[model samples]
Target: MRPTGVQPIPLASALGRIGLAGSGIRADLPLVSGITLDSRSVQHGDVYAALQGGTRHGADFAAAAVRSGAVAILTDEAGAELYAQAPAAAGSDVPVVVVPDPRRAVGPLAGVIFGTTDRDGAAPALFGVTGTNGKTTTTYFLDALLEALGRSTGLIGTIEIRAGREAIPSALTTPESPQVHSLLALMHERGIDAASMEVSSHALEFGRVDGVRFEVAGFTNLTQDHLDLHGTMEDYFAAKATLFTPERCRRAVVLVDDPWGRRLAAAAEVPVLRLRTEPADEGDDVADWTVADVEPSGLGHSFALVGVSGERLVLRCGLPGGFNVSNAALATIMVLASGVRLDELQHALDRHDPFTTEVPGRMQLVGEEPASIVDFAHNPDALERTLASVRRPGGRVISVFGATGQRDESKRAVMGAVGARLSDILIVTDDDPHDEDDAVIRRAVRQGAEAAVQEEELACEVLEIFPRGAAIDRAVARATPADTVIVAGRGHEVWQEVRGVDVPLDDRVELRAALTRYGFSVLSAPRIES
Candidate 1:
């Protein structure tokens, strides 16, 4: 048995059940001390899980783990066999637990050791937001709102993981179960009152979020994404729905603007707060919250929020784009439903300033001569919406986008089509060609753009630039004062993943250099969309 707190029993019990060639191990045998998957992070008394990978097996590092003071090992049967054959020093005094499937057990074991599930129910309220595109935006908006209301909050998302003053670079959109619980425990200890997290479908399907409870769950509209991993839209939707199920969350706040969200709202077991932007149709049932008389202007949007009690509140947002209005409304309703006082909402809204700052890569504008916009729009729907938003009078739209390698190749053409139909000039370039040929991915995106232009009967010039930086620079140099440049895909990512390695790249820095080279001044005013 592992020492209490040094390693929790749930993880210990799972480890103990593995038939090792040993007698009754003491509950405090001091065999295991900690758990880790990253070999570099292995510490004394840690059990390093050696998982099988595309190129190598974790068992190959058993000696290294043992040298780092790991008392036991948890791996699959093959790994166990390999461990059994190792030299006496490598296998000496260390127990090897042979689990049939080690990956599935990583989360549960992590939960037992570092998780806070056994703590009193006084854990801070947690809210989970999941969707393909708007998850990061909504999470940030929620964090801002919570913080404005004088609540100490923690945030976990694709951008970064912020807990009080400590900010760790995010490794995944959602952390693995052990890290998740460990972070939650840290937050709880630091006097955090609430937490807002972006839950990815991959996290749900892989049990990365197991042993964590959510007080409220939010859903934004879903579009084409991650089909390569999920295999089908149905499977993707099922994975997203897992967040709202009884096992994951206790209450649900769903946006009914998308058909899938409407369906999920109907299927959720917990209390559902249905939100919609458009008017209810004749056959449409009443929703918990509805927006009406939406007024969008250059300044921002002002709308009326009607609740189930027929109570109305005049709300104004400092964010542009019609989609942002919907996002803010959904977040507002979610915060309200979480038991925050309605009176406090006015102060929160008064202090709410969406345009004062912007999400790094989303709708970031560079250069003044021929304005350049950088956004993270890879899918057809997101690309279409973003292009439409940048359309201005007396200005032509120049689009620069590309598809990622090893992802759903089917969407390449769709993105291309949207760009060709909306842009005056199209530049197809590399996004992330992880382990795949960059040229192959660029061609796919170009094909999609060409097809869209043909279908729409529009004549647009399409250019292919292999290296993204050169393409963006050429587009910027060629643009006149009356043109707008849009750089799509890979928003807020600090590194570009190519051939299985992450290369340092920042879109904002590159765009600035391109603008300076073209003798154009960057805009100083804040023009960010949430």
Candidate 2:
């Protein structure tokens, strides 16, 4: 027998279960206790999943994995061949389990090894949200809703992974196949009743979400993003549509606020519950679930979601933007779809200060005197919403934003034009140049903003501040108490990716420092009780 929670499966049994081409697989292999793709994280009695990657092959590290106590080498056919020919084969009795498509195989393999195939009542209910924007906030809202209902929830997204209350920093929006299964198993063991995950387009395309099944998969609006990976909007939409397939998720809630979302709904095989943000916009029948009467006041917004049944529910959110209203509405429908009692969700919303629902670095107010707001609005759509949502009272909106390097360069000019249209003072700063020429990226955005100002005859003052911290300083120093400073891009990220190095540079922390320099503090403001 294995340990308490770990139920080890015989290597032969698991291989036969997944129906992979087991050409060179040994019949009498050891019972594997765990599975891992990373060689450094391998342990005794674990199956080392060697994969063929874009940049490098996992077979190259088979020796390290074996040395780290990997019992068997589970890899693709090519990887298996490489492992057999390599020096690691010498004196190694480990069986090389060959599979044609190891990427897809890993998910099922992980599911069997971890005992998550039986995602029944005892298992935590899974919720997955995917889109170009609002996925993070939507996941956060669903997690918060469950937490308010007195249920411990695990959260998985770009910022971090939380197994109940345990927070582990994460790299990808959806972690690797093995890690995802392991995290789900851990969440199950920890007594979490539900989990909310942000599924990225890259994750879908790369098969990161292969093995798991979501109880309710949600879609935020898709816009111009991740073009570098998908190459085109159609490909990106196709990648996102895979999540809504009947094989992937049981139910889905789609916000048909954009054309891409409408396309997703039309082709989705699974039963989909639709939602519309600007339901009263007329002409186009968006969705029966209409979000109307949106009032953005005092760092939060409240809206009524009228479902297809003509039932109306009013909910408030701390986050700004019509985009966030869509996120909140989608999250609500997801909660209801997950079979949570609707009254419980309503009670949670009614009793709790919905504004107190904490989403870090997303329209996060570091200082309220001059009203400093930091958001992870990287793309053109997000920037448009963030700039539009933030109000300046009697003063003007001073927006500090920049485009990221090596990703969807087409959006840079559009972002520049939108930023120019929204802000009275626009500062184009550096945001994660990541080995690409920072000057070139900044010039593209700045030129677009400058040209837009000239073309549209806008009075916005545009400036190029290479370093982000200086941009924060300049924006803060120029703004008064009535003015609002909206910092877009790189919201919750702790470090700024520059030249392949993640330097410690958090926008919220830097923005706070800038606010302190200007003699403004959040603590100095009056607090409102929910």
Candidate 3:
């Protein structure tokens, strides 16, 4: 989505700004108005970034991009060769700007081409949140808090991208660099004062956020997830740490509850404000802000942010669980790091109650009688926290979840064990097989649950059900009025991929219908269907 009213720059000038002017073997250059990575989305006067994929070269579609009115082709040496051989390059005068690493170059190119570069203060003040979990909720909290402070804000995260009231569904947690700059430019055009974004490890590693400086970067806790991409936890942590550099962000607010957060605070290249949501030892270095005097409110917690300098601010969140407290704390501290005064923020909180904003599919409530919930807690740590949080003193916790195919297979067993240990009834089901055999994925998860029940002599009942809709129905059918039925894994996702095909499956809709069918009263929020 390119912003309107930006003056176009010469293709040669855009390449020169990114240090690729003389290093290119190219043809006639034209004025470049926009940039895109996908050939299908190319517009008139756009530079088509032909990158190499895992199995296919993007240059294979060079002809299509040219036909769609691409003024230039941005590619690497290999991509240049492929484009030269492409049929569209035989007599085409389109310029081919070659770079050593096109992935990293796309950011600078897009920034320069779209007039969103650092030469002018054009982009909004960006707040970035990164971690294994809590990223989505924290971004939502950031947006809400910014709005409460009287700033028109934009949001870019797992669920959607927003510019004021308009929203478009998100395809990635962090989009490709071209689209990122384009969105930032669009937000600036629409007069959005601030923005909050979720920066994933994949985004950092793949240079998706290159050349975009955040006003204040935030660090949530790191856990064991996405090992398939990083290959190790250390690598994953390093990737997230890159976002805190002085070149990337002006300042940082880190949650020091875990060793990872503490390490990040000590290692960040920018000024840091250490925040702790849980208790710390007496000898430990005092955090810049600590969450204190926590008490349960309606479906949430009211807490005070006590600063090291005798500053105390009261804040409350409508989201449940101890983790949400951490999330809310992180959002508040990041806003303060961006220079919001205590009294100003308190006034907003008192009037708007922004932290209590509902983050869809994080810990979403669907019903009341049986206490139905739908969440995206696929990883082991998230599963454990969610299962423990949803438990009632006298009622049972019934969970229906499964592992996603081709993503950190080692966590499947761990998640299964966590579910079995914490839940009274664990029902294993399919979660987006994505070209892998569904039965094989289910077997591994079920085996882990069965093993936990046998080794620990747990009183939990384990069941394996396929075709998740039936599993959801079975979970509701077996639950009593006191039991809490949690449908975990695919939260807010409307499609379930099986053998490369997307099938319609929204957990909220499924849970709502099942709860209504079983005589349980569901929430009257019409946004659930939307």
Candidate 4:
């Protein structure tokens, strides 16, 4: 559903001096009620922005967008020239506006056409969470906690965008400027007083979150991933730092367990709430909020949240792992620092229990007998953490994972090495090999794993299997009742991309099927049959 809070601006009025030729063009130019770049999502009264892409030009799909009821077209000079030369439909003349840089104009034009001025008039409180990992989980926790505190909250992240019972599947980790404002407006109309969103580094760098005004910004420790896009670790970190600028957020909640987080806290202009799991060594003096005596059990964690004011708030988070305890403590401090009543703190944290249960694909366990975990741990840091989390006292750790095609090939070997050192048995498989040869990708990861074992002399067996379903089946069949099988990469994703085509595949489903085939009771499986 489109957000109604922003008044739709007339196409003619919004486009000041942009010339329109024929009367047909004027009549065709309906009010720009919405803006979208994708032809598939174009609706009546929407403007389609056509930009040149790497593989295909958006101008090629202009006809499709018009047919799908896009009222006007915004394109670069090349796209406008092409659209002008192309044949017009029988009774339609699509008005095309030729901007110098369609991408740059698309965002601001969306802001103007959508009437999203940043005038502060009691707008909903916005929270942004960013880092290499745990953004989705932390956002979910904040959303649930806020809602439980009698505040209607909207959530936008990797999994979904939810306001009340209405949910929209997310296309981007953070939506473009127009969609961001539009979603916020929808939440406002739904009586949502607050919103929590996952702000990705790419989204921040690309101006996808330009117009967002956040009250609280959060940091979940940074680690290696997305080096292919950013070109360097420094570049990746710079993008994340943009969210903590004074213009974007008023306060920051930083988890200083990682070196990057500590550095960011030191650099932030906004007041920071620092959370730590380990004992303070040399840096405890600078922390504003510190978590101490962290104890992680099967169900949750117990820790002490000590404020800089010397006030102690004991927090028992119903989220597994010590990492999650830091996440919860950071989130709790962020909300409390945002002016939440001290009396409401415990109740809000109590509500975090239910929130932790719904984090999709985050260490999600499946199967009854052998038991498997599906996590989005594609990088070395996350892989090591996942292995450490599920390490049973006397059980073996079987890991199934693969590197993505055409992205940070440098990390492939590192991931392999970490997997080899952590898991007793490692099964290398396919993970969104998008247009690249799957074997080549698997071999790169295998090389890393082999290097790790040879260099460190770790006693681990690494095996490569093609056709991801077969790999999952083999791993599940081989796992004993006491062993834990972790299926990493492509967590919660239903489609597997190969040669640009997305095929239907889900790891959890295949694992359950494999366990059932092996005579295991399916009653205790974590995933429900679809």
Best by TM-score: 3
- Measured against the true structure, the TM-scores of the candidates, in listed sequence, are 0.89, 0.95, 0.98, 0.90
Off by over 4 Å in 4: 4-6, 11-30, 89-94, 119-123, 281-285, 351-355, 367-371, 521-530
Superposition error at 89 for model 3 (Å)? 1.8
lDDT (C-alpha) at residue 499 in model 2: 94
Error of 2 at 60 (Å): 1.1
Candidate 3 residue lDDT tens string, 241-350: 99999878999999998889999999999999999998997767789999999999987899999999989999999987889999999999999999998899999989
Q: Kindly provide the TM-score of model 2 when superposed on the true structure, using C-alpha atoms.
A: 0.95
lDDT of each: 0.77, 0.84, 0.90, 0.78
Tens-place lDDT digits, model 2, residues 1-530: 11248877898888788785367667798899888889989978899999988888999999999999999988877897788888768878887877778888888888878877668843588999999888888888888888877888999898788987778777788898888888888888888889999999988988888878999999998889899999988888899999998778999998887777777877899988878886444565557588878887556788787877777777987766667777888988888877877677788889875534768777777777788888989999888888888875687999998888988899999999999999999999999999999999999999999999999999999999968989999999998888999898988877888998978887777787788877887633332111
Q: What is the C-alpha RMSD of each candidate to the true structure, in Å?
A: 4.0, 3.1, 1.4, 3.7
The digit string of per-residue lDDT tens for model 1 on 384-440 reads 878887776898888888998888999998888888988999999999899999998
Consecutive 10-residue window with the lowest summed lDDT within model 2: 521-530
- Local error of candidate 4 at 163, Å? 2.5
Q: What order do candidates take by TM-score, descending?
A: 3, 2, 4, 1
Which runs in model 1 stand beyond 4 Å of their true positions? 1-33, 88-91, 118-122, 279-282, 297-300, 354-357, 367-369, 523-530
Judge candidate 3 against the unseen true structure and give its global Cα lDDT, from 0 to 1.
0.90
- In candidate 1, which residue pairs get closer than 3 Å at backbone N, Cα or C atoms, i.e. clash? 413-448, 416-449
User: Which candidate number has the best lDDT?
Assistant: 3
- Report the Cα lDDT for residue 9, model 4: 69
